[model samples]
Target: MSALLVAVLLVPALGAAVIALFPRGRDHAARVTGTIFAAVTLIPIAVLPFARDDGWTTYSATPTALRPWTEFDVSWVPALRLDFHLGVDGVSYPLVALTGLLTVLCCAYTIGKVPSGGQGRTLVALLLVLEAGILGTFLALDLILFFLFFEVVLLPMYAVIIGWGGDDRRRAARKFVLYTLFGSVLLLLGVITVAVNAGTGDLAQLTGGTGLSRSTQLAAFALFAVAFAVKAPLWPLHTWLPDAHTQAPTVGSVILAGVLLKMGTYGLIRIGVGVAPLGAEWAAPLLGILAVAAILAGSLICLRQTELKRLIAYSSVGHMGFVLLGIATLTATGLQAALLGNVAHGLITGLLFFLAGAIKDRAHTGELADLGGLRESAPRLAGLLGFAAIASLGLPGLAGFWGEAFAVVAAVERGGGLWLTLAVLAAIGGALTAAYFLRLLRKVTHGPTGSASVPAGIGGAEWFAWSPLAALTLAVGLAPTLVLAATSAPVRALTEALR
Candidate 1:
């Protein structure tokens, strides 16, 4: 099983090497090969839950520690006490699978259509590199290892944005790298603090604030809060995101909105709260306040945006804000909701970016003033856009509903002056979410046909790229237990420290 985990981690990087080394002008073959490699990573992810250590189920229903279903660990640097450790438990598995699925889809999408500035093969290789980094971040059980994987994503993504994005791509890419580098510096500091003070970087030993004094935990969490907050782009730190997402290529936007932001939220869950429980409890109120602020701020900003892609980019702030809110509650229910919101946002928002990009491509302009009556011209595209928008606003029986709704429920459950107020504000934010999306629908799909002429037909490649995201949004929404099932025990164990 450990070997299987190692192979899964290596496969995408291998795909990248193969694609990069492919013969000149073999872009088509290189893309196909990259997609195949990406698909290969998914098989092991699906099989992992069955490989759980004995009593994964029995442990909590029977009382278990944080036991991963699959893990591979080995000594790396004896001096640093850092091991090359990786594992998949309920908390991280959903994200790993999300990363693999989106990467493969993006790779396949590339085979049919390459963005203008870059070669298809090159884009495919970058996607594979991005995938490997995201997967490694989710799986790494060593704090330093986690930071390394997290950094791996920065450069390739910047390359994608600048190499293939719009005319202003350079500026957006620069803002992205500089802001994240600022966060990375803090993340490195936090990781070093934990490793030096605890005498180990192994997360298996550090979870629940174990092996550290209260002062150390508090200090570490403060550093982590800022680092992950920047990554999360929480509220004020979020200025760089809209530009990056708006200027990025179609497939790049999908992956960016899909799973990249989850890295920060995941870090908050796995590192900030898990490794520093006391600080998490102490800081919960402040986190909740900022989360609500993001929700309201993002919603209001989105209501005023003129471009399609930019609106979708701002929506991520509100969506991710919900995920952060769930994490702030620090209850099992809240953590489970956080995980669900994380995955659902990937599915629903990925679809939204896809539809947004589709609209921009056909209309030749993303300006809202230029696009109208999409339903009359391209009903399928408009319909899909409507479905994705509704799901994103937390419509019932859609993938986006459970996470946002449960986040509010979890906040209310936390039951204090601060939390209760946050719940009310978050709910109002949800209403504003509906207002902006409906306003979007009114502008794009319901208004009289605009000057821009969009084709009535949808392409095979578009359908191929989009169907799974649409189907999964409905599937996960209706049966959220699919996401929540594996998460129960691990979330419970993490929350135990708070209790």
Candidate 2:
């Protein structure tokens, strides 16, 4: 069990090193190496169901402790009481699995779908490194360990955008780094305050202690919430996402939307809510307000977007709005909504990015005006686009439905007049989501099938790349219990801590 946990962290890092060693001239070598690395790493994730889940065990360094899925901890910084600690319970496990799965898909997409740019090796290596960083962040049980892994992701992702991105790569990368660093400063301050006040940076220990004062919890939670909300790219702070998504390469966009955005919501659940229950309770109303604004604003904004990727980026704001809203409720159903939404959004939006990349690759432009009558010349591609679009719109039996439905349900059941009103607003946001997607489908996929302007259909590689996402969208929708059951126990435990 310990070895598996270590492998989960090490596999991608090792793969990144191997990819770096590939000769610069051999582009295919980097692709092959990345594919192998991601594929092999996924094997352990597949075995997660068979892995045992015992009662909680803590690997404590004098002050801090690490509690992982199957615990492992060792000393690193004695003076600071920080340790190299990692763990995952049912709550964190699905996300770790999702990260592993998406990394494989991104690697596959990168290997074939992306254009043969100059820095292919660097791109692949950065992706591998990015995967490792995200996995480590998900598994880290120690606050300092989690923070280190969380920040580690930013550099590799920045390299990916700048090295292989579209026209405004430099500007996009700079904006991304600047915003993230700003958030990081706040996050660091918050973590240190919690650590110093609680007398430990161990997540389990802090939650178990009646250590920090309520005012202190509120102050620290506020800093952590803002930093995470930036990552969630929650409403007003979401300015960077559209540009980043628009200019980024296909795989970059996929990973950004699919896995990276979830990091914010994950941290809010695990760190802010877990350690600072009273603060979470105090902030719930404000968080709900911001979440509603994001939902309405993001949905309405998408209605006007001509560029496909920008539209998807804005849609993410709407989706994440629901995620934050769920977190604000601080109920089992609310947390469940947040968790399931995280996974569902990952699949559906990842598919959208994959399709968007494919469209951009073939049609050479993502503007709606430039993309007409796709169903005619490229029926398969157009069909896939429609499929992804409906999924994004929260069609009843697709992955998208559960997140929106569960969020609204959780909000309605939460019984707060303000919370219920916000949830209802989110429900209207759902309709707006439907409107934009239907509009997208009507313009690009349903009109004038016989036009010569439409590009060709999906190729074999594209189908192979997209099928898993399409399938998972249906799988999770129909059998949400698979996700619900896995997440319920951990969410219950975390929410219990809040009371």
Best by TM-score: 1
Clash pairs, model 2 backbone: 68-87, 68-88, 69-88, 376-449
Estimate, for each residue in 1-499, the C-alpha lDDT of model 1 and write its tens digit.
7776787789999989998889878889998999999999888877877776554433343221457787889999877777899888889989988998898889888877888997899999999999999999999999999999999999999999999999899999999999999999999999999889988888877888878888888899989998888887788799999999989999999998888988999999999998989889889999999999999999999999999999999999998899889999998888999999999999998999988888888889998877999989999889999999999999999999999999999999999898999999999999999999999999899988888988887777788889999999999999999999978878888888777
- Tens-place lDDT per residue, model 2, 307-371, is 88999999999999989888988889999999999999999999999998888777778888778
Error of 1 at 342 (Å): 0.4
- Which TM-score value belongs to model 2? 0.95
Candidate-wise lDDT, in order: 0.90, 0.84
Instruction: In model 2, state the lDDT of residue 140.
Output: 84
After superposition, the stretches of candidate 2 with alpha carbons farther than 4 Å from their true spots are 57-68, 208-210, 448-454
Candidate 1 displacement at residue 87 in angstroms: 0.4
Which portions of model 1 miss their true places by more than 4 Å?
55-64
The candidate that wins on lDDT is 1
